[model samples]
Target chain A: MQAAADLGAAAPSRRTEILDGLKITLPFMVGAAPFGVIFGALATSQPLHLSPFETMALSLFVFSGSAQFVAIALMAVATPAWVIWLVTFILNLRHTLYAATLVGYVRHLSLGWRFILSAGLTDETFAAMEDRYRRLGVHRNSHWAYLASIIGMHVNWNCWTMIGIAVGMQMKGLDGLGLEFAAIATFIGMVVQKLRTAGAQTAAAVAGILAALLAALPYKAGLTIATLVAIAVAVIFERHLERRGQA
Target chain B: MSVGIVILGMALINLVLRCPLFLVANHIRIPGIIEKALAHCPVAVLTAIIVPFALHLDQAPDGSQWLNPDLFATIAAVAASLLTRNLMATIAIGLGVAVSLRYLAVF
Candidate 1:
């Protein structure tokens, strides 16, 4: 009887974590909704001839927004399968960075928990989880929050993609409505709030300039290169500061 | 060459990249410097993604690139974010400015 009561007491806290996760993820969902619709709309049009089911399945399984759009553009040109695969891998290489950043906090979780959490590590989810973990530190209930975030985004993305596919089939120009700006705005909001330190600010400025300068690079390779270099710069700056302090 | 095969391959690639560290998180230790560097990953990666999109860098050199509504809206959004520190407010100001500018441009 006492054990049953304890389990009941613990359940609500987990529920609260999930609720909090959903709340935090709401803005990201709003941001992604248009992107998903645009993807769905684009995939069904032009030289690319994806069926609705194929379009939805891409979102359902691969679940990377930029990657899916890249694939669609390549497929329109009848780009070879191997090239598409290579590009997808390269485009998503940043996920490895995200996983690396988050591994320490989740190291204590079971294999199943880790697997589930890692599977949904998109940019928005990563931002949300990283913000939460950095601000609050990890606790026993943190995985529940991570789980809720991934699930919320996963469902929201797939549903919106389907809506886009449906709307694309019936309409002519839903993509022209400037809906994608929401995502850029959302990213700005997330990125600005986190630029609280000089080191972070310098890192962001370096990454932004390099990315813009190198934007002409093929297959979105510039993004990865810029991020890696910016992180290196920030690390070196910190080390310099440390040495100065010691002197 | 089926789309199904491509989708499966992409999914596998994503899984491989994301899962290995988590799957082995307890077994290995990251070096101190590398761990410290990873602390900067979010800002670096996110800013990289945002800059190209917000700046219209991918578009061909047109004199009007600097006059982009999206760029103005992004600047507005950044200011709103710094002032309010609220995500919804930032997006609202951004979209509001963007829509209004586009509407005026159309007329």
Candidate 2:
């Protein structure tokens, strides 16, 4: 009887955590919906000639918005497959940092659980998970919560992609709607929250400037280079400040 | 390359970068320098992506290009984000500003 009661008590909290995960992801889904739709529409249109199944599978498998968009654009121009792979890989290299940030929170889980969770990691999911980890730390059921958020976002993205494919078939031009700005706005909102420190502000400023200056670089390599340089500059700036404080 | 090859290759690349560290999180420790650098990663990366899009860097160089709708919309979005810090509001205002300016310029 006591074991039954304890199981009942544990079940509701896990349910609650999952529900909270959905709640936290609601805003990100709203932000991502238009971007996903744009990707689907673009993939199916014009010289790209991607079938609906292929488009859907891209969302289902590759699952990175920026990388998928870049790949589609490169394929349209008949860019070499190896170049597409290299650019997309560089675009997603940031995920390594995201995973590193999350390693501590998820290290206790089994290998299977880690694999499942890591598959769904993206900029939005990473942002959501980082906020949750920072505020609450890890709990017995935190991984469940993380999984729920990932699944919620995954479903949201795929659904929007389908909707976009449908809309693309019917309409002539969806990209002109300026709906992609939603993604820009969402990114700004997320980055603003993190720019409260001098080091963070310095990193953002330097990266932004360098990216614009290096915009002429082929295959979007400038973004990767700018990001690396900015991180180094910020770290050095912070260390100098620390030494000054000690003195 | 075939579409299947492209899809599988991209998926494999993404999975490799995202999954290996987590799979071996138990055995590895991120060095202090890399960890500290990672702390600033999000800010740098997102900013790098956002700036080019906001500036319309792909367009040919012209005086009028600098005054494009995306730049103003981005400025409005940044202000809205700083003031409200609400994602929905930021997007709405940014889109509102961008669409209005775009159609207005067309007329």
Candidate 3:
């Protein structure tokens, strides 16, 4: 991929921001490692029986964990390819919401930069990028930080996917490894790092409970619904606070 | 069925939903209220995403229901993160406890 277009004099310091972004994102990489392994192992199992190559191809291309898992599960059941496509599409439909929210930061870039960044835009990268944008706002070096978030997550994901597939082709069960729980730690770490206010904390807690309650909703629709409702709750609550000068 | 062919189709659809929004982003105007609301989006999204996975409905080997190692590990992780304020340390303690719980089958 192409580097994000340099913002002239701001380019030099961006190199450091890029490093900082990668350093901060290290925990996420560690957290996602187990899930990646599980996905690889699942791809090769009964019903799916996909060769390691096919599994890798899915990870290499789709790069969406939930989407790939849904696809493989659907394929295993001989669900029509179109249904798998549709379901995965709906599951990933949340990406559009993330893109709309994130585009505010990158709207001034060239189409090439926008497109490349878009390809790297997964749920993980979206969190990391949006955090940087919020923390740093519209600085010149901010684009480089964004680029670092994308490349760091992209490489980390693909690398783990390949390793999982490689080990899966050789071994049997990876779940016994118990590494998948790292994703929880990673998410927890990230969430704690950003809980700078009571409103943010409230939104997170509400979203968590709502997600568990609504998880039975089909097609992962619960996540999107819970997020929207939680955002509304937090925003409304904050506005109320502001009225009394507490905000 | 060609797995490769199906994957390519999914890839195409994924790209369509992801890319065009950025292209169209230049045309839209975000109100101050909407932008402030959007500020809440990342934390909300990440929280919702993590909770389901942490308390996954899948059964444990010991036939326990609704209680699992992930829940404890997550609580431990949050506490460690708050106290230590260090990412690597939080992950290490969290994953260590989770794996240990699963191995010991204390649940």
Task: Find the candidate with the highest lDDT and give its number.
Answer: 2
Candidate 3 residues A1-247, lDDT tens each?
1223443455548679889778767877777777687678667654356898888888878888767765775565354566566655655666777788788778877788889888778887888878867765665566677778778877888788877777666655444545655545656777799899978888898998887887766656667678778889998888888888963
Candidate 3 local lDDT, residue B87: 68
Give, for candidate 1 chain A, the lowest lDDT window spanning 10 residues.
A1-10
- Cα RMSDs of all predictions? 6.4, 5.4, 7.1
Candidate 2: deviation at residue A136, Å?
Answer: 10
Considering TM-score, which of the candidate structures 1 and 2 is the better prediction for this target? 2
Question: Candidate 1: lDDT of A159?
Answer: 90
Off by over 4 Å in 2: A1-51, A65-114, A122-150, A168-171, A174-179, B1-10, B25-27, B61-64
Encode model 3's per-residue lDDT on B1-107: one tens digit a residue. Answer: 67898899888878987898887665455566776676676678768766776676323212235577788888889899999998668878998988899889897
Give the clashing residue pairs of candidate 1, or none.
none
Q: Where is model 3 chain A poorest over a 10-residue stretch in terms of lDDT?
A: A1-10
What is the two-chain DockQ of model 3?
0.41
TM-score of chain B of 2: 0.77
Order of candidate numbers by lDDT, starting with the best:
2, 1, 3
DockQ-superior candidate, 2 or 3: 2
Best by TM-score: 2
Instruction: After the best TM-score superposition of candidate 3, give how far the Cα of residue A106 lies from its true spot, in angstroms.
Output: 8.1
Clashes of 1: 0
